[model samples]
Target: MTGVTLAKAVKKYGDVQVIHDVDLSIRDGEFCVFVGPSGCGKSTLLRMIAGLEETSSGQIHIGDRDVTGLDAADRGVAMVFQSYALYPHMTVEENMGFGLKMNGHPKAAIKAKVDEASRILKLDDYLKRKPKALSGGQRQRVAIGRAIVRGPEVFLFDEPLSNLDAELRVDMRVEIARLHKEIGATMIYVTHDQVEAMTLADKIVVLRAGRVEQVGSPMDLYADPDNRFVAGFIGSPSMNFLKGQVAGGVIVVPALENRRVRTSVVLPKEGATVLVGIRPQHLTVEAGDSSLILELRERLGGVSYDYLRSSTGEKIIVETRGDEALPEGTAVTLDFDDTKAYFFDGQSEQRLR
Candidate 1:
């Protein structure tokens, strides 16, 4: 098995600790993504796995071997960096075969490997072209081909699509997905874009301040979050948080004009402050007695988002797929199912279950 495992991993710079003690296991041939905000140490952790960063104190196992102290070249991992670090003077074929040639591989073997990688990446047509002559997406594919030719047990991608334009990013995303399916190598990708993480990963490890917040499949984190942060961070447009309090065996949301809402879980003690979470997709705009003022509407072809402000100045986003457009400055009532609502303790910021 070419799985990767980290046991009590910790990274520190002098007295300040960056990567907290983390324990994780990535199965063989699984696509795992490390996702978080900048400075959360996702890239640092990826580099640690690739042997590019030193592990302060922990055991890092790649397959059956403990590779904690091994150099990058001995780790059997190929990293595709964000920047296309190609030799501008060399052709794509030469750049892809350079590593093997330096390692004293036979000319015939190197040629065969390069040819296979070029075919997989659809770079056969541009193999003779220099980096300066190819487009950004094509250059990135060449970089990936370089890694493919190495035939490492694991592949590390560090925001490889971030440098490309939006359209090119989408195109490269599909290409990478296809390549993963074709090669079936253990892949660990790092990205700040949740959409990329959601679309590409078989399992997602959400990090915050160098600590693991949650680790699960994308839909697991989306539908069954363990805490408030996971609930808010995993979804697009984020989850709306409204002020509420537990009173008389029910939760009452002040932002919704003290409407009594029911919960599937046991309520906290009376007068305890709590937060009511509703996803934008779950909320519907309808005529009612609620005091939500529509501030703006964003139309995106088949769907739309209505930005509303509550009486308490809390901003709320409501997603509607209907073709009818709601005008601005319209006072509308927001409706949502009670079962779809999430409750969190305001003091601890943890989900109230």
Candidate 2:
């Protein structure tokens, strides 16, 4: 296993900066995931780490070695691409041993490595099958096994599960989690899926438009977000943003009861026009006040209900247990639990209180 460090790493396509001096250190054997929307430069950053793409400036270190000028083959890092990149004509065993063969490893050694990888991935029965003969999940496993046979210090996965079906994706995700525990290799995964990042990562690095937005554990980013963008982005259905300001020690929302959405958090300053973010799960829907109108309800088993806040025309999804159904346009009370609410400064977008 190897720890990776990127110091002031910058990537630019001519003048367009794709990565803005990112400085990050990933610990040895840690499963770190880089997560963001499309065009966020996540893949570019991963390629840089793999040495498939060069950094515009700064340094990259793997374990104790400086590898900024190294080629992909010499970086001691194996990358599994989103496309799988398997040779269609080659059998699973051949594909897994291809890297070793190209590097001039002995046939017997290659066979041993392939056999070991096949056992780990449970692909022993499918060794002679070509890429076309295997299922999507199996093909992905071959791709992963290929990386495994290389015995790299660090592993890079660029949305390796994106091509699989929903059920297959879940299966592969569990498989990958198990693989990490079994191998204990340093892994850097890039994905746009929050569920993937949340479930797989030991630490998640959230990126946006060439900048690192936040880096933390899933619960840290979910429970205590650094900014409004992070607070909204990390959670499913997202947190609710209400237009409010501090008035006489109370967060005053004109739409709620008593013309105020009160909170216990002490305002850092007065006359601050801030956005009050309350997660959908944090809002209590009750038959108390009149302003809270339930626009829609999506009941998905015993987990929760997704209730759209009708009062503000904002899509608010509430998580509640049981088969409780609130009809569309049902007027109800919305209570923002003080302990769960987060205040954000309007201009800076920084979290307040």
Candidate 3:
């Protein structure tokens, strides 16, 4: 029930550094998520906080204690990894109580904690079952239950649901969210899945190449990203980018059949190339005698994403509702509110406000 703080935290191995100076603060009882693509140092940063990885410099404080040099077991943090590291021979109850048992806690006390955690995770019925006897979701719940029984001040999860199938992943997401709500413990979750981060995090830390890109609430990052990397990485289907050239205070997009888009944001110098970004939801398409072709249409129940490609091979995804299908070869024209378009510097890929 305490917050975690990182002050200019850095991690290194001999000569190469994997985690840069990362400054983050996870509020008390907050669900903070570290999210980015693979090898982005989200997991490395999480391990640094869990004391699994040594901090090369700076300080990590779990509440008021500087746990930078503490052993993993002494850090007061429990980490559930991408894999459910369960003992194949132990029953669910035994696995949940193993840590306390090893720590020399009384049998009665261990049982009480195990029972309470099992009740929270809805694993009371499967307590007698071994790992081999349980489904993927059950095994993951057992893993989480194991962490809960230890009663750590902070819980760290490194993609705990990645092993589950699509259906089970959704179910476990709900289960984990509910568990956090019930226990109200400070949790730090790491995942490459943006959907998981968007759905679960109270605050999200977006990382790339060992650097902290941006940190904010889900919608805050979505609606207002500091750079093109964050803007493209944080949303589903991702935001579409079209190249444009500044001319007479307007952007001319060749992908849109040389259409001109005017924006209120200050423009770059004349003839400077810029990136015009528009989310799929903001783009509307209509059948017309234009070079943009409807390459494919994916029907996903209530929503459909119409894939379009221009003469220059620039691809765009137009998200639409309903099950209607547009012919693959249909020529289309793209329409979007000029106000909704975001302009970014083509060179730096940074947002131009």
Candidate 4:
């Protein structure tokens, strides 16, 4: 069964159309993540799914039921926002069971559900405390506990860990992952953080300016992006695009000696301008058949970044795990794994071969 489906989804705010036509399907029990930069419409899309925003055109389905026109509460989905919207006056147990009480659930049933959610979220000890007494992570967990008590068919999280510090964020991320595993419920998470998307998603939906750029597993998007935008967006430090020309069935870029260094990117004709992309981790400061000229290395503790200048003046970054020092002004030769290089048409910014 599909947990959610959006067909030709679009959103328009006055004269500006935010979301273009987007089609997506998330499978049952899968943890899907929607990720993009600010104002890219990821959060807008999530809100549309939650019934907080009306879609200008398209259909939204949750577990075989069409929810395009439904109210937020009628959609049978639970949402955890970035801010833990707990009532300051209410205790943790009261906040967790508030929705159930408002819906006229029996007191005993509400208590049972709250207790179960508290146990799952490690909030059993804080059940009597107000929101002011809890830490950021604990308060966020209470927000999540509120969702858990509803036992919805689907879970929607909009940057739920964004309020915590880095260490707490990591801890909450693990908790969310574990919660998904234990509940076996379909979840959709929205975030701008690439690390969160890469680590948590079973499938990633990459968005740009309200349009869907690519949808795939984390590694699939990382290893084989459909275009320059996706190739550049998926990894940390980003992929390096070196300016080169496609000639003689090979990609030719200049070496430090001003000689043409060739690689295995096949071209249909000679002298066709193309862009070559390689991940920072894929390049090494070692001489090989496919060497690039590296300069201006930056060291930051355990990780070091090498600034590489191609023959055509395109600058690329090469990241290494160890803190090895290389001369700043001296030219170092870098070898890229041919198998990892991505070829794109220079004009269209689209993947070629």
Candidate 5:
């Protein structure tokens, strides 16, 4: 149960560099997740920490040891990949114990470790089953069980639940969270799924194009993002952005029928362009002076979302918990507190405040 640290880590392939100087720290027994879009270098960074990819520059330390130059097997870290990669011919029990057996652990020790892992993963009933006979979730659990039997100091998961169906993904998410609590081991999970990152991570590292965008708890990143990219990426339904510019110490959004919205962030200059961001949940729809037309409505049991299009044609999503559904094609006003709004530089896409 130890932490991991990366100091100015860099990775390159011949002339091209994908992972920039990344400096990160994961606390002991913490569930840290690396999350971003495809080719964002999250997987590369995870591989670097697992010693699968060499660090072209900088250092990586697991616990107290500098493991930058260590081989995958010597780094005291176990990786569960996107694929289960199970041996087709072996039973669940055999697959789980294979790593330890290959390491020359005694038969008794291997069986004991495998049994413990199976118990943790709730795979005792399927121990005798081969890969082909088990469901997708079961196979994944077996893959995780294999990792657990090795008893590595840190566990690295690279999109381990991507292959599962929606229902199984949710089930496995709970299972993995439970596993973390039961084992209390430092874990680093990589995924492009923001929902998974938001639900599973104790801390999240948001990466973009070989760079660290932001790092914080899920809500922290959601409520307060450092840049436009992060503000838009971290939340479900995404934050709605309206084009605007500063005028008379307020931001003027043309999409809202030239309505002026006040912001606490200092304006760059009068008429300087900026982006106004508001979360869908923060928006309230009511009869008012604004000229927003409800274009569509999505009712999802306990909640509903109203999709609106402004006079300027900018689309907005408004989340509501009301039982009554708003009729589409109805003209309505969208209201939100100015303080709840986020301002970003139009050019840099950085948060103004």
Candidate 6:
């Protein structure tokens, strides 16, 4: 297995540029994920690395050799796409071996590789089954098995689990994680789901508008985000942002009943408004309070998410344990540890720290 490096990489079609000057490094045997919303150029960047799309300028190096000008087939990388793309008439065993056979490898060599991939993916029993007979998760495994048979230096996955159902998606996420541990290959995965990025990646590249926002380990990005976009994007339910105005190094928030938030982070000029971010996990509500109303409650088995709406229609969500239900119109007061809050510049939207 080998690493991948992109230096000053830029992609342009005519005069319209979708990918900007991006530089990234993926170490050997590392599982890196490119994550962002739709049209963020995550897929286009992956395609460029795979040699499926042309690089208008800059360089891409796989391990020690520069593969910028190489063809897709000559890049020593195998890709598993969103669709299975399996041959309907062929059996699982035949499909897994087809790539090697097309390259004119000996039948014996192809069979040996297929057997190994089957064992690794636990598809030894379904080798003779066709795509139509396999479950969605099984078909995805076969798609992955096809890539594993090639023994590429790097493996690229383009949202391979998006097509699966919720349960199947979870199951395949585990399977893909296990596959990486067993093979220890350099793998790059793309997905908009932060849950997948948090659970599967050793490193994550957060992108937006064709620009790389930040790159770091899952916990590093989660616990300490550089900007408002990353702090909101890395966590589930997201961090809440409340408007406030600075007064003598203190932030006064109207939503928290003019609560004073004192943080060590440098404050802007007095009376300058800023943003205070707090995760739902850190927020709690006091029943029988003024202003804030319990708008809705979602009972999700072990935990419940309570949605609160202020008199001004500002929304806040609180995650609490147990399945207790709160009345829709019940009055409440928002409470949180002031030290746990994050301060951001209102105009630039950057972290104040």
lDDT (tens digit, per residue) of candidate 1 on 1-353 = 28899999999999999999999999999999999999999999999999999999999999999999999999999999999999999999999999999999999999999999999999989988999999999999999999999999999999999999999999999999999999899999999999999999999999999999999999999998878888888889899999899888888887788889998787678999888999999999975566888889989988889999998989999999978876788888877999999998889878888
Local distance difference test scores for all models: 0.93, 0.87, 0.94, 0.87, 0.93, 0.93
Question: Cα miss at 203, model 4 (Å)?
Answer: 0.7
**True lDDT of residue 60, candidate 6:** 98
Task: Please give, for residues 1-353, the per-residue lDDT of candidate 4 as tens digits.
Answer: 24999999999999899999999999999999999999999999999999999999999999889999999989999999999999999999999999999999999999999999988888989999999999999999999999999989999999999989999999998999999888889999999998899999999999999999999999999988999999998999899887677656667765433334455544646787777788888877753333345567777888889887755567778787765566665556776667777888888888976
Return the candidate ranking by lDDT, descending.
3, 6, 5, 1, 4, 2
Please provide, for model 2 over 126-237, each residue's C-alpha lDDT reduced to its tens digit, 9 standing for 90 to 100.
Answer: 9999999999999999999999999999999999999999999999999999999999999999999988999999999999998999999999999989888788888787
TM-score of each: 0.98, 0.95, 0.98, 0.92, 0.96, 0.98
- The order of the candidates by TM-score, greatest first, is 3, 6, 1, 5, 2, 4
Q: State which candidate has the highest lDDT.
A: 3
Candidate 6 residues 1-353, lDDT tens each? Answer: 99999999999999999999999999999999999999999999999999999999999999999999999999999999999999999999999999999999999999999999999999999999999999999999999999999999999999999999999999999999999999999999999999999999999999999999999999999998988999999998888888899987799998878889989998999999899999999998768668888989888888888888776667888988865566788998888898999988999998998
- Clashing pairs for model 2 are none
| Candidate 5 RMSD computed on C-alpha atoms after optimal superposition onto the true structure | 1.4
Better of 4 and 6 by lDDT: 6
Q: Ten-residue segment with the worst summed lDDT in candidate 3? A: 320-329
> Which parts of model 6 are misplaced by more than 4 Å?
none
RMSD of each: 1.1, 1.7, 0.9, 2.7, 1.4, 1.0
Candidate 5 weakest lDDT stretch, 10 residues = 286-295
Worst 10 residues of 6 by lDDT: 319-328
* lDDT accuracy of residue 269 in candidate 5: 87
Model 3: lDDT to the true structure: 0.94
Give the runs in model 1 whose Cα sits over 4 Å from its true position: 287-290
